[model samples]
Target: RDLHNRGGERFIYNLRAEPATPEFELHGKYYYAQLAPGTRMIWFVNLSRQNGFTGPVELKVEGLPEGVTATPVTIPSGLTRAAVILSAKTGAKIDARLVRLYGKAVYSDATGKPRDLVRYAHVTCELQVSGGSQARRPINTQIVGVTNPLDIVEFEATPSKITLRPGEKVEIKVRVKRNKEFTGPIQLAMPFLYGNSIIADQLPPGVTMSSDSKARLTGKTVEGTIVLEAATGDSAPKPLERFPIAVMGRISMSFSISTNYASNPIHLTILGADSKAAR
Candidate 1:
């Protein structure tokens, strides 16, 4: 629910935003690379947790130049999400700073008419901004243009949070996207560092611990799991602990490419002998 324009400003038109309703929600990316001549980019629009908004909903791209266009897509009822492609023709007006992007969702009510909703965040690129400069990385879908954007290696965890006391173990399901498209084995891991310094005596995540440390991503599969354990029979009181985690999806396309996906710093806390965890 935290929505803010990153590295740039979002534009607001005089259009009236629809009142917040319980029907459906729309989400898009914010950052994208500068478009070159004669090329296009693909991004996603996701609508989920639907209690209403049935029937077809039209998607539109706002704030682009004359030559650049977003292929408007309509999400049919009962479907959750779909992709929209944005392209700049070989002669499209191009400006790295002037051209910006966002998305809007519109749906009709029971009377079979069309209406408008507020402008919502539209997905652009998997981006990283350092020192006021920016870089765009490809994610989810493949990019096939001279824009030269890099691919993103990220993962989303099923049950993102886990809390267990000493002597307990839990399994966290990991699903990765944009891993190098190869047929080899993948290694998923977690950081076992204590405090700011790594436990250098044992390098590489999960290797210092029990069998729950590592896993393999099978053929064309995007799923894996993380098994965490608090050593048994050791009731010594310790501060809450956190770790950084990522998965290396092994593929045949290149050399030592770190197609690694990570998460926000995940922590473990022993609230008591029997407290439960929530996502």
Candidate 2:
């Protein structure tokens, strides 16, 4: 990871970390996640293999500040990336800290005996009381603090579930309940995008939001519609059961940074053109 100190000077600590033997390196981007109490963020992990090393790696995060927790990840052999979900509890303490990312695996030694090996990486985390503020820290450290809850407290999609056929179109209504502390406008969407680039999308392939959607929720406006259109013929997604999706409320902090809150997941089912539901 490339990191900068509080003074803005950029450097990497591992420039001289050359290993003399065949091994794998655990690494990931310097992630800056600012989360509030009761919110969560997804952190990504990466791996680099050297000297013909090919083994499954078990990954985990350590040194998380109080009130913040993360689930461990496992990168299978031949895979380069994995993700960990970090969540904060309600009434969590306001704090920040640097966390450690470690990976372990078993390899056969020259004597054909299984040997345990481990590697390390660093990540930064922060929990802030407000959004859109710049908080600086040393490399390989994370910050966790408490911020105000998002304007969207909770939301639900009407219909609760969906069953549609190929070439059919439907609309899902999202009703957002505000936090009362935040009265600003909020954009309700199904896909999370960063500056015209898709970051994470919740919709399944062949089922897309329509172009003419009015999904902006302003003051006193709590209801919005998301029109989903299924593809026709061969382009239609194959019959699938119980696809989970949710609505995301986005508040942009900058060109590349934003805070997103998600609603409950709803199930969607797609049927073939000539298929019929069982009685």
Candidate whose lDDT is highest: 2
Reference-based lDDT, residue 203, model 2: 55
**Cα lDDT, model 2, residue 189:** 68
User: For residues 18-114, what per-residue lDDT tens digits would candidate 2 score against the true structure?
Assistant: 5455588865444555556766555556678878788878877777778877654456665565555566777777777656768888888777889
Model 1, 168-249: lDDT tens per residue? 6777776655436544555555432223332212111122234764466766666777676665445432323332222222
TM-scores of all models? Answer: 0.36, 0.54
Q: How far is candidate 2 from the true structure (C-alpha RMSD, Å)?
A: 7.7
lDDT per model vs. reference = 0.46, 0.66
For model 2, give the 10-residue run with minimal summed lDDT. Answer: 5-14
Q: What's the lDDT for residue 265 in model 1?
A: 27
